[model samples]
Target chain A: MNERILELFEETPETYVSGAEISRRLGVSRTAIWKHIEELRAEGYTFEAASRKGYRLISKPAKWQVSKLLNGMKTKALGQKVHIYDEVDSTQTIAHKLVASGAPEGTIVLAERQTAGRGRMGRSWHSPSGKGIWLSLILTPRIPVYFMPQLTLLSAVALCRAIQKVCQVDIGIKWPNDLLIHGKKVSGILLESSGEDERLKYVIAGVGISVNLLEEDYPEELRSIATSLAIESGGKVSREELVQAFLLEFEEMYALYMEKGFAPIRLLWEALSVTLKRPIRTSTPSGFIEGIADSLDDTGALTVITPNGERVKIYSGDIELK
Target chain B: MNERILELFEETPETYVSGAEISRRLGVSRTAIWKHIEELRAEGYTFEAASRKGYRLISKPAKWQVSKLLNGMKTKALGQKVHIYDEVDSTQTIAHKLVASGAPEGTIVLAERQTAGRGRMGRSWHSPSGKGIWLSLILTPRIPVYFMPQLTLLSAVALCRAIQKVCQVDIGIKWPNDLLIHGKKVSGILLESSGEDERLKYVIAGVGISVNLLEEDYPEELRSIATSLAIESGGKVSREELVQAFLLEFEEMYALYMEKGFAPIRLLWEALSVTLKRPIRTSTPSGFIEGIADSLDDTGALTVITPNGERVKIYSGDIELK
Candidate 1:
């Protein structure tokens, strides 16, 4: 009914229609139409009104709404349930609590702003209101916990595809989980899991994509290393459209991952990988291993050919692309 | 000063010497001895009265005190700082928060009971107060996050060693992280990691050992599957001594893991693994594979020879021994 009222007001934007005509067109009482208008007005909507002329919606706030967001999200499972929050501490925290309470798989939590956003290593993510898409997907995958690293790569590819589709910008996945454009990180993926030994319950992949952050918005340490889609594309992008596209792409890639295993997704990852076939050194607390990158193995472990011509399997650690 | 008091108390059990004599013998003050007595009494000790008679220790409770437990713990870095709690929601929860807050490596959180104790698969662990040892070890390993499966195997071996030393019972590590005695689970491990992509900040291995639960105390559904040291040994074991032994063994294993690799621990795990050299099938979310148990690889993945004579690798999952 509210959507109908919105449509009626949108159809005749510059003119006010009488309550009797709106009631007759939408099959609702004049009281219902007036109530809907009042609700819309309460939701930060501007309406031009008169005594008997009824209401004409002048404008609606430019913020992500559940109806508008899901209306454009065309994904099978991802974005099936979209939750929009005006402000949150962290989307991942909310997603974890939801998953614990048996929230459906593929439910997404998108916040307009985050007060305590997080990055990969417990770092704070600077999420200014209405400037970035802070989203987290609750995924219950039928895969061993060891293959979780691949999901990070897959999500990076999905984000890159979405950015390319929305802003026509070339984004590459930096090894591990950073999305970079022109050697500057535009997004980050923080994947957190809660599970037992045999079964993985759910993984919350919290993604923070900087869509319109200006140069001054970033911290001094992040100025040289981080970027935004607006900075890379020279224009601001729609957060709703990009988030929808990402959900669609992620659903497709995740489906392929479930059906064909990591082979297909690994190929996609390798294609979008900026560190493959390059000289890289992985540093662990023990020491550093300098080697030439070779390829990803079946289990997603990176196989590196060392200076001594020995193959060292790098399961995981900090990878520095040289 | 307290150590000297305890030493003197243990030396003369039934006698109470003058404070002046003790101060002259230990090169301390009567005030120091009085303070030590006050501290010991605060730690659940009953002391006899009178200034002339000094302090005569009547009895001591078996609570896990940091000073008392660390005195006997022979670990290098694993149990240097012991944080004992009468009750906690979950040691893993506190450990994860502590890890994020830069808690030093080798810090241990031991709880008499866990209100929301967790097992391998987020299942409830029956950790009744004064009944079991629920401990979480904060470790900063130099290995990649993928190799975290090794910690499970290492902890299993360490616990088995400690248990076998005291109870003379053989325990087996069921696949990923369960410790079984007489084909019934006596302990479980929950390993959690937090860090950046590739770089592991810390790994918290929360271990729950049912030391002294009677048969009637267990739920009916768990009676057939779970066993405790008291139930198996027909007597209550010292929880403090068990905790000390576990910390000692964990420190030894952790030291070896940091200095060497999983190769040495692999040998120990193979020796204690009940699933090795048997007909076993591991059920993963991807698929279930039945094969003859071969051995664990250097990276802690279980190697199984399938019926078709092909060796398949099982990283982290449930394994059923047939």
Candidate 2:
């Protein structure tokens, strides 16, 4: 009922929708329409109702609603099911619940603002309402857990491609799972999975894109180091469009990685990598090692040749160019 | 509180302590003790309570209860926190819940019987009441998800040693994660993990040992291929003792695998391997490959040399001796 009313409002925004028109479109009686209007009103919807003009939807409470996003989704499995929240603690937290309840691949959990959003190593993510995209995708890839590093990097590439096409800006991916522009962090991906040796049950890839954030949206500490689409492009980019484009690109990359293996994804990632073939240093548990970035191993570890010409496969750590 | 009462029951199995003694030991009044005893009674615990004498525990519904398992567990972590179930759908199901609740490593989820126990490739595992050891161990190994295959094999080796020490029988691991005796299946391991590319959150290694199941216990279908510890040794093996032994062995190997590498475990595994350097055939999704089972790689893949001398790393499949 809410969808029917919202669609009508979306189509005829310039004029008020008549009661008879709503009843005919939704196949409901005038009394049913009135009840729906009352229900929507109770749910924080404003309607300009008059005797002659039926209802004019003033505003919808949920800004980035699921019903709006699912309107033009053309992908196969990706974004086929989207769960939208007005506010959430974190998309990954809800994604975990969906995984526990046997939610399939391409299921998405998105929120307007994350009160306790986290990044890699449990760092706080600065997400504000009507600013950035805080979402997690539930991916069930039939691969060993070791190949997860590739999946993480694959997500970064997908995000980079999606943003590049939409915003027409240059972007590069950091070694493991960060997207940088002008060597400033604009996006970060955290890929958390549940699996076994042979097959992964589910992988929750949480992508935080600075889509529509302004200069003031970023925290005081991150002013110089952080950026967003609005700040870079000086234009209001639709969050839904970016999300749809990312889902399509990720579906293609994920399917290719699963069918033909990680070689293709690795190549694409290397082409856009800001850390590859550069004099770099990685902080590992044993100690920090300064090396030249060589290539990515099949397992997705950064293969670097140290000063002594000894090759080292660094699994995970913060990487910096020397 | 339950543990305290169980300890008291364990100490005085024959004689019933007075109400005053029970209250003093438990730091509770007689009314509190009576309420606890009533709650236990409602939960299928039978106790003989007198006016002056305290509760004499007559029988515990589950013999290998959590309290019994943790009585004298010497390990630092493994099986330190046992979650016992009288009857459950699957230990893996409960283990996932514990992982979500951030249960510490060495936490165990065991059941007397599983109505819906499952094995690899979605096969049904026959778990009967009071007959077999159906338990899942939660290990938080701080390793990449890719190295899970090695952990699966490591678990197989740990089980082999534990069963040998408890039952005094020779056992062999079937390629990836199965235990065999006299060419018949005696145990199986299912290593399920949750994590991302960087570090794994937890690995729920579900070990199902056919300890005391008779030939009749298995249906007509599994009788020919499956055998039990009691069937092979002709003696009833204690499930609690086997669980205790397996936890200890697993903790030791897990520590070594963390401090050292897979080298020592691989050597021990090779010493007891029955499939190594033998002619074998594996059924893979691509096709069947007949080869000489040569050795295991560092990542625990079975390096099989095909008839034409091509090396094939069989990740997962059924194996048959040619």
Candidate 3:
């Protein structure tokens, strides 16, 4: 009933739909329609009210609603089921719950804001309200547990292709997974899994894309290290199109990964990577490793060679480089 | 308070401890002491009572108490903190919760029986009450997530050594982590991880050993493929002793694996392995591979030299060998 009311308003955007028309079409009371409007308003939807004119839909927040998000999506399996929230601690938190309840693969959880968004290695991700793509994709991939971490690298390539197609912006990828634009971080991926042995119960991939947040929106410490597509382009961007493009790209990449293995995806990732062959310094568990970022090993580890010609395959670390 | 109640019974095993003396030692009423004893009894504890003499400590079921498991554990980290349950759905389930709640590394969750004990690749593990060692160890290793699965193999060797010392039975370790005795599986290991990117949040290693289960304890189907220590040794075995020895072995092996890479553990595992240098057939996702088992890779994957002279790395599989 709520989605029907939303559809009536969304079908004729920026136009007023009378309470009588909505009630007649949806077989609900005018008071029911009013209650629906109030609920949508609580979820960040705005409507202009007039005494005689029922209600004019000033805007529709379908990006924060599953019904509208999947109302006309053409992807075969991706985003077929959508979980939406106006606000959340993190999309991944809700995704875990949904996955445990047997949500199918390709199910997505999208949040308008994340109160405690997460990044790699317990780092805090800056997720502002109603800005950026704060989404987590719940997947149940039938693969060995040892190769599960490779999904992080596969998702980066997929997201990179999506950003290019939707936003028409070329980006450089850091080895392993973070996305960079002009040497500043534009996106980060966090993958968490629940499984026993070789089979995964569920894999939740949390992706935070800095889409429209301005320079000042980031904290003082993050100002120099983080960026958004809108700030770089000096224009507002459509997050909906970007999201649709991402699901399509990710579905394709995931299909290819399952079919042909990571070899082909590795090629595409290496092509878009800028961290290769660059001077780098990484803080590993043992100590600090300073060397030239050489290549990505088969397991998606960043292989760095020091000045003394000793090679190191670093699986995880904080990287610093120009 | 619960641990204190358990202490008197454990302190003088098979000896009578007067109720009045117990009340005076713990500063509780005689009725409170009786209540605690009843609570313990409800959790599968059996006590012998007489009119003149107080409760005589007859036997102990370790799953009802955690303090007994850690009372004299010598490991610096492993098994220092133990969570005991009379009957759990699964120890890994509780271990995951504990790890999420900031349970330190080497925290152990031991259960008398699991209603739904999980085995490798989602198979059902037969865990009879008070008959087997059903435990999950929580580890917070500082290594990369890709190398984390090797701990399962490291654990297999540790358990093998512990079993050799406890039961005096010569066992053969399958390529990856299963412990086989007389060509039947005696134990299985399941490794689960919660992490993002390259760093692991925590690794939960669930180990289930069929220790004292009788021949009739196993189902008809499991009788051929699975055997208990009691079934093989023709006598009842103590699970508490096996657990303590295994934790000590694991602590040593884990310390060595971290200090020196997987090389030392790999060598030890190779010495006890029966699945190496043999003609083997395995069903992988790609297809079936018939090969001669060559060696173990650095990541503890079985390196199989196929008939076509290609070395295929089998990460996880069901192996039939001659």
Runs with alpha carbons beyond 4 Å of true place in candidate 2? A1-62, A65-74, B1-62, B65-72
lDDT of 1 by residue, B107-166 (tens): 989886677998665568887666678899988876655666777789888888998888
* The 10-residue segment with the lowest total lDDT in model 1 chain B: B193-202
Clashing pairs in 1: A196-B120, A196-B121, A197-B120, A317-B198
DockQ of model 3 vs. true complex:
0.41
What interface RMSD do all candidates show, one decimal each?
3.3, 1.8, 2.0
Give, for candidate 3 chain B, the lowest lDDT window spanning 10 residues. Answer: B58-67
Local distance difference test scores for all models: 0.79, 0.82, 0.82
The TM-score of predicted model 3 comes to 0.80
Task: List model 3 lDDT by residue over A221-292, tens digit each.
Answer: 888878998877777677777788888888999999999888888889889998888999888768899999
Q: What DockQ does each candidate score versus the true complex, computed on alpha carbons?
A: 0.19, 0.41, 0.41
Residue A230, model 2: Cα distance from true site in angstroms: 1.3
Q: Which pairs of residues collide in candidate 3? A: none
Model 1 residue runs over 4 Å out of place are: A1-62, A214-225, A280-282, A286-292, A303-322, B1-68, B87-103, B114-116, B194-196, B199-201, B214-224, B231-236, B286-289, B308-310
Candidate 3 residue-wise lDDT at B158: 95
Regions of candidate 3 where Cα sits further than 4 Å from its true position: A1-68, A198-200, B1-68
| TM-score winner between candidates 2 and 3 | 3
> Scoring model 2 with DockQ, what do you get?
0.41
- Top of the candidates by TM-score: 3
The fnat score for candidate 3 comes to: 0.62
